[model samples]
Target chain A: MAIKEGIRTGGRSARVQASVHAAVRELLKEQDRASLTVPQIAARAGVTPSTIYRRWGELAALLADVAVERVLPDVAPLDTGELRADLRAWTEQYLDEITSEPGRNLMRDVLSSACPGYCTNILRGQLQVILDRAQARGEALPDIERLLDLLVAPTVYRTLFAEAPPTLEQLYSLLDLALPGQDPATLCHCDHRRR
Target chain B: MAIKEGIRTGGRSARVQASVHAAVRELLKEQDRASLTVPQIAARAGVTPSTIYRRWGELAALLADVAVERVLPDVAPLDTGELRADLRAWTEQYLDEITSEPGRNLMRDVLSSACPGYCTNILRGQLQVILDRAQARGEALPDIERLLDLLVAPTVYRTLFAEAPPTLEQLYSLLDLALPGQDPATLCHCDHRRR
Candidate 1:
């Protein structure tokens, strides 16, 4: 209650939210989602339970925030003049992040909640930057939005459903097919491309 | 234990599994994942808790089976002579299924599990059938495996992450780009094609 009653000191609110968010993440690692209580999170974060309840309303809402901001990696855009190289680099990076434990957990938690759109914004923002770079280089890309969907959805699908995450070769293969002039023979093999 | 021991009769095992599985789904609908217990599922299914524990071992495993077999819809392969038309029909069908509540739940549950490859086989099997048909018809398709990813992944990604699932139009555009010679002006609009 003391923390919540305190005056807003220019981003101090953000600092408090960050600490609460970090506490939520740490608690999650050690306990199951069902067992987690707002009071417990509040205690762990050194804030009043009312603060969490007032800010997030429910545990799922708080988890959604953590998933988007902290759990999902911030993917920087890559811009090689060639679309093939740029695409492979970006896809691999994206894949690696999502396949990690925290990444997978965040994605799962986000999907389970009522609002999946929160994660969508994060995914779209990252992919849009990459596509924008390719477009600037005069690549005759497909519908930029659709191109992103094509590039990303299957990996998520495979990752969620399949026994293994698609190999880097598989990602490169998809890019080759999506973009013109990149021969599959050269693109599908990650090892071949590097050499 | 008695239930499991008494299941050697014809179709009895199936009936018991079905009842147990149905009970699991019903219980999930009423409670969050963390709140669910084997005894609750067993009681709802009219079986002993030990039967459930012996069969599934954990809630996640049971949910995984349900997700793979029942939650995710069966996507039949489309075989329209034109690749553009076939892709549009297939994509729309797939999108509608995955974006639904059951589809979304199944996906989230599966992703939460250690093994994601299970869904990959389902996705791959459906896509492979479509690709093989296209190949048989001699369509100048992109790399078959990559084509599957390009066609399916982005839709899954956008559906899971974005505010709106990829529209039929977006899917058509991606297909148009992937398969040579289909102009976006003509493709990418399902409404236009229907008319």
Candidate 2:
């Protein structure tokens, strides 16, 4: 997040940017994405929204960047030396944050107006970072993409769109099933017949 | 649905209520739940919003009723003696719809909101009708609630929030793995290693 924020050549210097980030986090904690308009954000940050507009491109993009940057830092790097354990830990992290009021509320807002293509980009971009980091040291590079989709799809549907929430145990179990031997490609096609 | 709509003095007129059902669905397709004003619906339906409001109370409640009534007719009766097959068949109906433009757009609209609880209510009420009907028929209903969540959650998360679309084959494989005729009570635990 610091890295991304530092990328901008901005009118709002370091002090102002810090204030803006603080205000964004405040709105996020409140889980009031709808109420966090540019003017409101400006008021919160003690600056004009023109300051916000200058720094971040648009309303959605600003929120999108903030959401990804704030949330992603906490979820990366789960190396337990065992794929199943690592996946389980990550799943728990993902589930806990997502199921909470803040997480669910933020996800609901993002998903409501999200474009399918943009969604794919953000997910692949974010999850890929985690996947690549997890598999960076390993020899047999497996495609976790399909398995990630399968493993997490149900939870997202249920949480964001369905009636129930997928429990932590379910998430761990799904990850275990998906990463039977640190291999999602093979696991995806595993003989999942009625046992 | 008819039973619920029967409330609010809309007595003994099935024929009149049918057009309202179609109008809600049509209106929903064109507008987000938030943007959908009663006047817009009335105009489209060739009736006044008052007429629509008089027929159905609050906008949310009216929309909710329409949602219940629209999908209820399409759900396959659980008479087919198999759980996996029945769910597969049930999910199969909307495979294309969920993946295609309209379904995908509507899904994105719903999830991008920051209010999970309200969204959950609408989804739960609608999906539960199907699940309740299936369970009522006496098929070995194991984790019917979670299973339904598991089925729809992943795709929605991926499509709406993550931006990835699941192919029918992907959905097929998820169902195969998720509801495999094992002790569904076990999977219902959703916890891999158990507490």
Candidate 3:
């Protein structure tokens, strides 16, 4: 292959790896996740098939890694003093992505895979990476990770695969019930503001 | 269909519709949302192809209606005194449903669908039915309805459809951020919360 060779780890290598990474990202954007083949990656990267395969076992693995990498930085979530603001920001970013052609296409192919384990594994890994980051920052309340999952899981399920939007109003409503830091006793009560 | 044609409501004819409904519900219990079809539904009901299409338009519509109907009272959600307790109860129920054959199957199929609008309609309708009833009883927090879409949508998407399950920790945390009712400034963030 004429494009590049070997994993470049040094300062110069960073540029090469960046190129490879960019190629991978570009492939994902252009092709359906299901249709992605090593030949294509190699052709696009100007690298050998062995290089792509050696670097990543399969397309799903590569896509999973790339998805985690590319998606997080832009939409990784902001946790200011308030959870709602942070989440709204998070939701807005995700909304843009999922509704986008590339994101929607990528998710559809990924979720439609026959192997349930793979689907679960990639999504779990991607989520954990972001959630762990949020938690480490002290922005996460107890069960904040669960909040992230609950808030998001249903919307996607209802939308991408189920093929419905499930009303933004109701979705946001559920989010209010689910976000973080509120005392359960108060939430449970009719009067509510005992604080 | 002849099992109770003469009788109405609780009799044999009604029993058959009941059986069809039950079978549909049970099938949802046992399969992934990804692996559904009219033949499958018919087989599950021990009925013929004509019986299904004659009665229902398509697999999506039938499943949508059946799944929606079953989502209501068949599995009671949390109405306990404390919000956290109720949330825990609800989460527990969701966990049970998802883990069950029908729950997993139905969810998988629903989330796997490509038509976002259609899925949205079904889930929105289902959520509305559930929330409306809860609201009428005055147990539901006013703002929670609006956020409900954000909260539950993501969970479904994240779990069977997205990359991971919303960890129990996330769920608990989200409830806290949500339930306390917003401050005056925060109140303006959402238009529907005024009720």
Query: Considering every candidate listed, which one attains the maximal TM-score?
Result: 1
- lDDT (C-alpha) at residue A109 in model 2: 47
Model 3: CA > 4 A from native: A1-36, A64-93, A112-158, A161-195, B1-50, B60-84, B99-104, B114-147, B161-164, B167-169, B177-195
Expressed between 0 and 1, the share of native interface contacts present in candidate 3 is 0.42
Candidate 1 Cα errors over 4 Å, as ranges = A1-10, A25-33, A43-50, A67-70, A73-90, A127-144, A173-195, B1-79, B112-115, B180-195
Model 1: how far residue B74 lies from native, Å: 6.5
Encode model 1's per-residue lDDT on A1-195: one tens digit a residue: 122211223486787788888898899889987898989999999999988878777788787777666545554667767666777777887788778877777777767676656665566666667667778887766444544665567667666665566888766655655564444343232233344
Give DockQ: model 2: 0.27
Q: In model 2, what is the error at residue A187, expressed in angstroms?
A: 11
Residue-level lDDT tens digits of model 2 in B1-195: 122421223444454466666777787678776888877777766677776666565576566555434333433344455566666666665554566675665555444433334434544454455556657766444454455545666655555555455666777666665553454332332223243
Recovery fraction of native interface contacts for candidate 2: 0.49
| Candidate order, DockQ descending | 1, 2, 3
C-alpha lDDT of candidate 1 relative to the true structure: 0.66
**Model 1: lDDT of residue B122:** 60
For TM-score, candidate 2 versus 3, the one ahead is 2
- Best-fitting candidate, scored by DockQ: 1
